[model samples]
Target: MALWALVSAVGLAVDDRVLVGAPIWAKPFKFFVSFAAYGLTLAWMLAQTTWGRRTGWWAGNVVVLTSLVEMVIITGQVIRGKRSHFNAETPFDASLYTVMGLTIVVLWAATLVIAALLLRTRLADRATAWAIRGGVLIALVGAGLGFLMAQPTAEQRAAGNLDTADVIGAHSVGVPDGGPAMALTGWSTTGGDLRIPHFVGMHALQLIPLFLIALVLLAPRIARLGDARVRLRLIRVATAGYAGLVALTTWQALRGQPLVHPDAPTLMAAGVLLPAVAAGVWAALRTAPEPESVRTKTEPASDSKEFTA
Candidate 1:
């Protein structure tokens, strides 16, 4: 996958063809990078499972296999100078799209199985445990959001293009696919782009774990974080906040609002969520009992030496 990303990067630089108003290699490049992260994260999560280890392993392999198949089809279509998703201009294109859909469905189910197995297993660190669990849970929802782009828009339906149109669905809601888009990402700037929420939601698996790691790195400098219980509470708060972010982004996209141009309602929703999350973190810190590590640090020299001895 990493090699594919490098190849795609070269293609992006050299390929002169444009499809849907973006570099033809762009989608394949992004997919290669995303699947790499997805596969690695799932493999690591499987290792953390105690019970149902075999099931998790199998599920992880399924993800790897399906991801490979999906990337192959996408890259193949790119080589042919054709659009990958929602392309039904010909019978072959339609069949390939259908296969891609089926593979993703299988991939999603495999991830769900892995998530269930992880939920059953207990980890030593509470923050790390929930980080894996919550990340996978929210990632599933994010992956599921891709289906929203599969359905034909109301315009397509009203225009009677379901049978005759070259493309049956779109990533953009109010704007056509080959319109003004954000650089690099190709997300529609004038309308809601489902890809925004989908990308953000799907990456929770990486984001949440990184959050815990960040908190741990800061623990020595922030006394309250020395308490495992306090860290766990903070993790819970962060996970909730992350979930809310996913929901908010999804809602914004569905309402046909561009991410950068969020209106009053979107801003208001964020306003409410920000303070709640801050309050949760503050309460967790304020209520935490002084950690044993802090007590040890403050102990008399003789007591510390005796404890070490």
Candidate 2:
């Protein structure tokens, strides 16, 4: 779903003057992957012994809180018809601009906290552990691109602060009078294909980890579920829910019909990317392998003997 949201957002932004300089394909992919990265981080932390439960709880709290802040802005946009200043060349009220910075700061705090916890929980298998580690590394790249997305495009690249005949600092996105004439205050548009990378980074939190979870949750019973049938049924339902979400995105796209006549890409966004992902997951599942490692609860996974000769 998160990846889908990002892809649709990219599609919407593609032709817009504000994002024209952005590498469309790359940006959305970057942003979409951040979620999966985060998920893997948390999962790895859950496996680690370095952090205590309290650390996990704290990290979870911060993540939840910062996510709420992001949700607020995204929700507000949904309700109030606003564009993120970072994405648009809009003049923001100074205070709101500050809030955007604050939002990133909090999110960073969450990531750092999660990273600490992740270092504590080591996955059982070397390969799985390595994959999660790779996730963390990629996440940093996503973070950098995020900073870039908030930058100005045209005039910034030019040399000389020559007070152009353009002191008026005036110009907007398009027919709907989309973005503001001037760039948002805290943004920086440095990297050329930053958005693509950003999309890749952000969605990692959800996509990759959920992919892992689906594996762990469904494997041929590593534990004693009171009713095996019931547990399997629940797992099936959960998988369906996740897959259904992807399907839902598809439905949204079909309903929007490629956002044709109505010309409401923002509205159409609800339909596209998520379903595409859903379709991917569904297709992938047919060939999906069982989650590799399973330690019976009766024998704790972390035995001093396993670490010994």
Candidate 3:
């Protein structure tokens, strides 16, 4: 773990000019070591989870742990590298990244879980509740991107009809030039790197869960009038949109699109996931039960500023 962190720290600090395929020696170690570190970190997290207290919070701990580990990695790199390492691509696959994509995924999920946990509190205020929800939603989107990138490359996608965009082709190797805008509430990089499956998966995981879980969290408390069963059904119907989006991303990644053009692939991707998500969200908005209670004001706790943007 220490070694992984060290390498990531050193690698991300390299100059961008060097990263866009720089000469040897000056280039950073491909993030393979970081990936290894993340994998080990995850393994450690699972090992620590004894089932007695294995709430989604473990995900949060793992996320924080991952961040700290990354901080250590980046810190070390920053102190000594020739240039300040930027996240822009590097020579080697892993080298191109400061922290590997998988770590980002775990970190994102952890954040989501933490935010969701926060929302459970009575809080004595509405802003706090909204803030918690917003936090969770953002974290969820980040996690979704991580999940998407975790997927096997296009080569792996071709193995079966998983119903996702196949990365096997010449173009499948990287992010589309023009992809749909995907972020929780703002344009964080977690939402911007639409090229890799991991990024897409991470963002999607973040989004789908928030909408899906909304039914469970907000439904009973705010639901009014109609049969309990009817409201519950509506909630499910509303959340179904997110589930469908997950499915669509998985599909297209595994399979190449039918159309052929520069932006065709990007368009097809949007067509598959966004339209469905839009419909589902529209339906939810139209039918979602109005809240009966008013929220109070409270200090909106900020998560540990684990790393700088």
Candidate 4:
């Protein structure tokens, strides 16, 4: 992952030349960074599982191999001065695009299997288990968003673009491909970009697990609050809020609203949702049972094994 990050940095530094609507090295740099993050998160999650170690091992291999294939193809295309996604300009490009699509489908399937394994296994910490399960499921939804980008939009069809038939759809909803974008991310600032929710969803695996870790570190303090169930309830509340945020962002993007320039209705929706989510969390905490520490000298040993990296 560190090596990929360094490579991404190098790609960014030398991406002054433009190709196919953006910097020639932009796609490769983004893929490198994204793959690094995904690899680290996936590895951590697999390490936490006790059951299906063999399945997890195989699944991890699949993920790594497929991810490499994706990055190689994307980077190779950029080096060739061609669009990686939605490019069917030639027989070769179309074949490469097909292979990339199929590769992602396999990756998604492997992720589902990992999610199932996580669901069936019992972890030492229920909150951590819930975090992994919820994170994978939410991440799958984010992965599925790729399908939306894979289909040609009405606008694309109307434009009679040459690559319209061979290429999948695009990332930007209200703007043409390769338009003005945000600095580092290159997500469209002038219109809705499906990549926003997609990116957020992908990182749930990392974010939710980190949240679980924070809760675990604070377990001693939390136990003093007179509620053993507080930790579990907090996890549930956070999962709900996280899922809601993903849905909200997807909705916002579908409505052609840019992430940075949300309109009145979007703001109003968020206003209502924020309080509702807070109320849910408060209710969960308020109704939790008294802390076990208040009645007992020590907590019982957990049956599950500790997660190792």
Cα TM-score per model: 0.93, 0.44, 0.36, 0.87
Per-residue lDDT for 1-309 in model 4, tens only? 457657756876876778646677777777777778788888888888888999989998999889889888887887787888888878999889889999999999998888888888888777778888988889999888877898887687786864546555789887876887888788888888899899888888888888877877876777532343676777788888888888889998888778999899889888977998799778876774663455547665575454333
> Where in model 2 is the C-alpha error above 4 Å?
1-50, 87-92, 154-193, 204-309
- Between prediction 2 and prediction 4, the one with superior lDDT is 4
Clash count, predicted structure 3:
49
lDDT of each: 0.90, 0.44, 0.42, 0.81
Residue pairs of candidate 1 with colliding backbone atoms? none
| Residue runs of model 1 more than 4 Å from their true location after superposition | 291-309
Looking at model 3, residue 62 earns an lDDT score of 84
Sort by TM-score, best first. Answer: 1, 4, 2, 3
What RMSD value applies to candidate 3?
16.0
Best by lDDT: 1
Per-residue lDDT of model 3, residues 121-196, tens digit only: 4533333234334434533553464444444555555566543422212223233312332232111221223233
**Could you tell me how far off, in angstroms, the CA of residue 148 lies in candidate 4 after the best superposition?**
0.9
Residue-pair clashes, model 1: 0
Candidate 1 lDDT, tens digit per residue, 5-101?
A: 9999999999989888888898899999998898888888889999987787788889989999999999999999998899999999999999999
So what's the TM-score on candidate 3?
Answer: 0.36
Q: Give me the runs in candidate 3 sitting further than 4 Å from their true place.
A: 1-18, 21-60, 78-197, 204-239, 243-309
Better of 2 and 3 by lDDT: 2
